[model samples]
Target: MQVDYEVIIVGGGPVGMMLAAELALARVRVCVLERLMETTPYSRALTLHPRTLEILDMRGLKAKLLDRGKPITTGHFAALDTRLDFSVLDSSSNYTLIIPQHETEKVVEEWAKSLGVEIRREEEVVAVHQDQHGVEVVAVGPNGNAVLTALYVVGADGAASIVRKQAGIPFIGKNSTFTAMQGDVVLKNPPESGVPSYFNEQGLVMIVPLPKGMHRVVLIDPERMAVPKEEPVSLEELRASLLRILGDDLGISDPFWMTRFGNATLQAQRYREGRIFLAGDAAHIHFPAGGQGMNVGLQEAINLGWKLAAQLKGWAPDWLLDSYHTERFPINTALLTNTQVQSLLFGSSEFSPSVIALRNMLSNLLQIPEANYRLATQISAFNVQYEPDREMEPHVLNGRRFTELHLRLENDVCQNAYELFHSGSFLLLHLGSDERLYDVIDWSKYKHVHVVRASLAKGAPDWHDVHTALIRPDGYVAWAISQSESNPMEAIRKGIIHWCGHV
Candidate 1:
């Protein structure tokens, strides 16, 4: 069985392209098969949460993204009046970047192409067959039918994934309960004030400003809740919904794009089957509450890409590849749960008095700093914590994202911690005066790990007490130790072997 590529990714959305770029960064041969000949014009998702921005920063894409989108310091939870204050988050990028999904795809596509990823557009995957050695993918394109073989195949296609269906993976979840409409339209008489959100006895409506003069309007009309998804969304329908929700229609016209969606929530029973795996909408779908769909998919790609590349590269631990599902499934489950709750909170055509009281109570609670911070962290994904391997006693910082800190390298250059991860490799940062820490490990053996001896700058109180730490490529602290550790060298060796594998 000769493999044409190390990996073949079905669908060239943000997740697929992100994984492809990551594999390419590791010099793995990868290709993306997409059914669409070009990028989508419609912007389905319009915001990148805080954690997502931090991930992009690790790869040096954050600046470019910031240039294209506006950064809003505050976000909302279930459209509540109390704002989730992103500015209070403990990361360099603590704000949500309001960039369109289309622009996001374009940026990731360009980055993937630059990394030598072979993206074959207009190629639709029809059938997938896998054996112990490799997986064979049958795709139909403009030219004809072709079979491509790869060591591994990942399905990033949307909800109606052909790869997932052909693989016989059960997508277990509920169907749409209520339907809603969304449109990007030019408003002749736009509301002169804040983002308008109305929830009453009739339905829910929200109007947000877009990049151009267009406004994005979302409406859930109980009367039209039974509207079939296949039916086209007309300007008149949007206008009528607006009039019903608001006193006036706001003069919406010349719609750029319009579509209908539902609150159907689903998650794949498993993320991987043999050599074929799932990601993005192929793995899970829920109501677009909190604007988390694309962000979660992108984060999933980040989690899977490095592990898959490590397996192909032959340095991966036996449990490394499987940990992808072990680590991400719980997060996806939580995401589904929260979105379902939000659907119940906002998807209704009318809010009962009890529901209004609940909303008011919850909003008041969010006004409390701790309560707001907790929910904000969850929504922004800043609170994601993976379980550390039980081989050693866990440090509090272990399995958590390494807080961004400034470091003064031996060469006297000062930089933030994220700059060290731009190369997508493990960083062994020694934050003490003991240069002997560098001699504890033989550098020649671990080619993917870089060792840096530096001292913490003046104001990193979170990391000031930490003498040494090993940070993973994904920007999480694999292991850390305070100044009081008895056997620092031995502990460091154990941590390295546990995380990076042995020489």
Candidate 2:
């Protein structure tokens, strides 16, 4: 059947744009239908976690974001005072970039456009339908409604996803029992020094600087906790919240943006339903704690992007398409739990002395480096690991996130391994001098895989025993063949066929 696009993405947020770009990087024909003609003005999601920075770094997009955002070595968990330290991570992109959501969306969108991704703004997708052959999306715009067809459709739409509903995917979670308010404004009498979160019987409040001449103030006020999320927030409301919690407004004035959000957490029963798939807020929604929402969505985009591209390009194994849900579902499940846990700490319902004491205790525990590192890895998403496929060679590196490796080329020049992934090709990195497999596997057939024979320039303890490794497009170790293997060359051949397709 003829399709308008290889993939049609609904929603033009960061996740949708990122997925579109990733697919386009592989030369897949893709389109994005968005309701807004322009990017959002407000800085919605404030921070990009460490793992997200790593993903962007692999694509060579991290430098642009670094130019636009502030980098912080620390991240928050449940509004704790000690803060999770990201500097301990072993990568150049270790710090969290405190860029506004708008900044992130624009970067991904520009990259997508540069790659020839067709984005139809001011077009809202109303419904999605799919069968064994293909999927169709109904969109409404100023020009009027139109139906678009594609081999696959992805829903990057928000919490109230029409795609999920149309596909009959159950959204499992509870309604919000409480809400929090935040605003970007000029803090006339701002705190003199460091920005710290305040938690007391009055309320829990956090204020951070934004990109423009504005500060983002977020707090869970006890008195205003039960207000519906749909209600509009006013400058007086924020001023009142400040006075109630911190005793002074910090000379708050000149409101730029204000809104109320709730703790209504939801997750899709499944990320994929036949030809239609879900990503970002369509897959899961949680209370905005630790600034992890948008970061998680962007991660999902990368995970799903290359797989979809592979499927459309006809190099994907049958199981490759299904692996997207298998891999990301559990990660997001933990994310939802983490947000709910943070919601409890934020005093979603009761703000009593005990809750205050609990927060203090956790904060103190985080001061210990071990405890801090444990939570830091989880919050930064460095802890993600997928199980190795049964057909592949078994190794510890299988399914683990690929850390940046300093590699020396055959010509003796050295460069970072992440630089090789910018083209979105599977990297067949043969660290040892085994070239017999090269003759066994026809190089012309596996055009989608980038085979590089290089040695580790710098010592990476785990990679020391690796004779060869197959790295996925999204920067994850798919298979690592140990030098100890008696038949290492054969394993390398199977690993390539396992991921890059038998063709």
Query: How much RMSD separates candidate 1 from the native structure?
Result: 1.4
Work out how many backbone clashes candidate 2 has: 2
| Model 1 lDDT, full chain set | 0.87
Candidate 2 lDDT tens digits, 1-503: 99999999999999999999999999999999999989988878989989999999899999999999999899989988899999999888788888989889889999999999999999999888888899989999998999999999999988888889999999998878899999999987777655578998899889898766678899899899888999999999999989999999989999988999988888999999999899999999999998898898999999999899889888899899999999999999999999999999998867899998899999999999999999999999999888886787688889999999999999999999999999989899999666685786898988888999999999986899998899999889998988889888788788888888889
Model 1 C-alpha lDDT per residue in residues 320-397, reported as the tens digit of each score: 899889999999999999998888878454567777777778889999999999989999999899997577666788
Instruction: Please give the range of 10 consecutive residues that has the lowest summed lDDT in model 1.
Output: 347-356
Candidate 1: residue 24 lDDT (0-100)? 90
lDDT of 1 at 226: 89
TM-score of each: 0.97, 0.98
- Kindly report which residue stretches of model 1 are placed more than 4 angstroms away from their true locations once superposed: none
Report lDDT (Cα) of residue 327, candidate 2: 94
lDDT of each: 0.87, 0.90
